[model samples]
Target: MNNLFDLHLQIGSRRARQHIQDTPLWQLKQFTRKKKVPDLSSLEKFERSRKRFERKDRLLAIASLSRFAKLDIGREKRKGLPEVILAEGKLATDVAKITQAMLKRTGRAVVSRLTGSQVKAVRSIIGKEAKIEYFSRSRMMVVKSHSYTPRQSGGRVGILTAGTSDIPVAEEAEVIAREMGCETRSFFDVGVAGIHRLFEPVRDLLKWEADVILVVAGREGALPTVVAGIVDVPVIGVPTSRSYGFGERGLSALAAMLQSCSLGMAVVNIDGGVGAGAVAALVANRVGEYRTRVA
Candidate 1:
């Protein structure tokens, strides 16, 4: 049933028509096979028919290291998305082994989280074979970018930041959106303190014709609400952990965004720019697809 639609044109006329009829009995037998079964065992008959329903999708490989790494080999076909590695709570050596394993299987590459010190360990492992980049604010190092060559798509997404202090989170958003095939634009460092500085870029972004806006901010996090009032499209607030003396940098921002007075606004977690970017891309794709269908 997994590939039923595609199989319609592939199978023999008689065999295919028979399959449509046999599926009901197979399903009924399967339902009673595990239960009381009325009298004799229906399981033996169900097992024979179950063989016809095997899934046709690619199997994901789980790589073992200090922790578990699940590689989604079918992401390209199923979701039109690339695979990413979340590098957290693991040692440098551990990540190195996992990355090497994934590279061997997919030759596609892997992204993992690492600190500056851990990058040295990873450098020793992969050397020049991999193209690695470090995100300073996210405290993460990524090892893969060859997975997808992003193409242009409609409904541009604007990545905005409160100030230079929020660059780390903004970078994560940029990385994610690029991989998702969205035509993206970014502007940073225009918070509410000097409200005048924001008007110019905000005006320019409207001209750019964005479908959604991701506002990355820390501290008081009043930027997203103000941005919502100005923009006509969806405004996603990203609260970053870029503060101190106030629930570690992110706590205050999170609380402020959650309690915002704006309507039709959404917020992602502290420094969760990747998730926010992916969500924005999904919305952009939907908008584009709907327009296409209308046209």
Candidate 2:
């Protein structure tokens, strides 16, 4: 198998050199001293620096990939979320290999939309290397290294689903939020059809000081608006493809969510549990920071 990281050092070093060459006029003296370059004409020096800078700006690091997939290893540092493999359409073997590579590098990997066969393949490929947790409802898998420990304190996310049909999506959000260093509470089957069911869960979440809430629904998609109206925290709406006919395949639900009257409500794509989870995590993180400052 071709190695993805094989070109990492080579590319990084080359870029670093090019960056030095691009150093501005004021820093050209230091750059020359560092490189031990002999004296050159002022025009030559300026031209060389400009070309170097341009090259450096245009340079792109070689993709980090094994054979079939490119890995974003630095996403966690840059975006607060590691690259998660979406295994819906890929070959099972390819998923295994990519997930294994990620696990080896990060000591943890999340694979969503996994088929049963893909899950088995991943487990077989990464055998004994990590602890795997599978959520059948969500078709998601989480592989965690034994030594990995997250900070004890972080934000809180409340995940609510309109009906049992939406639990799969809600669970996906729950897993992603928890993995992103947020405490999560889940409430299911609380659609607006029966508004009373939402009260207790909402109260509990408020009492627990949840920083953000994720509301998953289908059909009219009114749950998010209701939740948003009640909570001061940010509310992320996830529209699931749970209904057929007028709001068939979640299109209507998505539209309803987008047109919500609630001020703090945000909507994700149909069945976009991951996106909703990510947004909720970011909001919760900010809330946590604010709380820390206040205290």
Best by lDDT: 2
Give the local distance difference test score of model 2: 0.82
| Runs of candidate 1 exceeding 4 Å displacement | 1-68, 75-80, 104-107, 110-112, 136-148, 246-248, 289-295
Off by over 4 Å in 2: 1-63, 151-153
Best by TM-score: 2
Q: How many clashes in each structure?
A: 2, 0
> Clashes in model 2: which pairs?
none
| TM-score for predicted model 1 compared with the true structure | 0.71
Q: What is the lDDT for 286 in model 2? A: 74
Lowest-sum lDDT 10-residue window in model 2: 1-10
Q: In model 1, state the lDDT of residue 272.
A: 87
Per-model TM-score on C-alpha atoms: 0.71, 0.78
Q: Candidate 1, residue 250: CA error in Å? A: 2.0
Worst 10 residues of 1 by lDDT: 53-62
Compose the digit string of candidate 1's lDDT tens values, residues 1-295: 5443233335446665455435665554544455435632333443344444322334343444444566666665456555666667777776677767666665645354466656677778878776776666665555653553445556478888999989878877777776666778888899999888899888888898777889999988889999998889899999988888857769988988888888878999988887888888878877866766787
- Cα deviation of 117 in candidate 2 (Å)? 0.7
Tens-place lDDT digits, model 2, residues 61-82: 2246666787776677656776
Q: What residue pairs clash in candidate 1, if any at all?
A: 87-113, 243-249
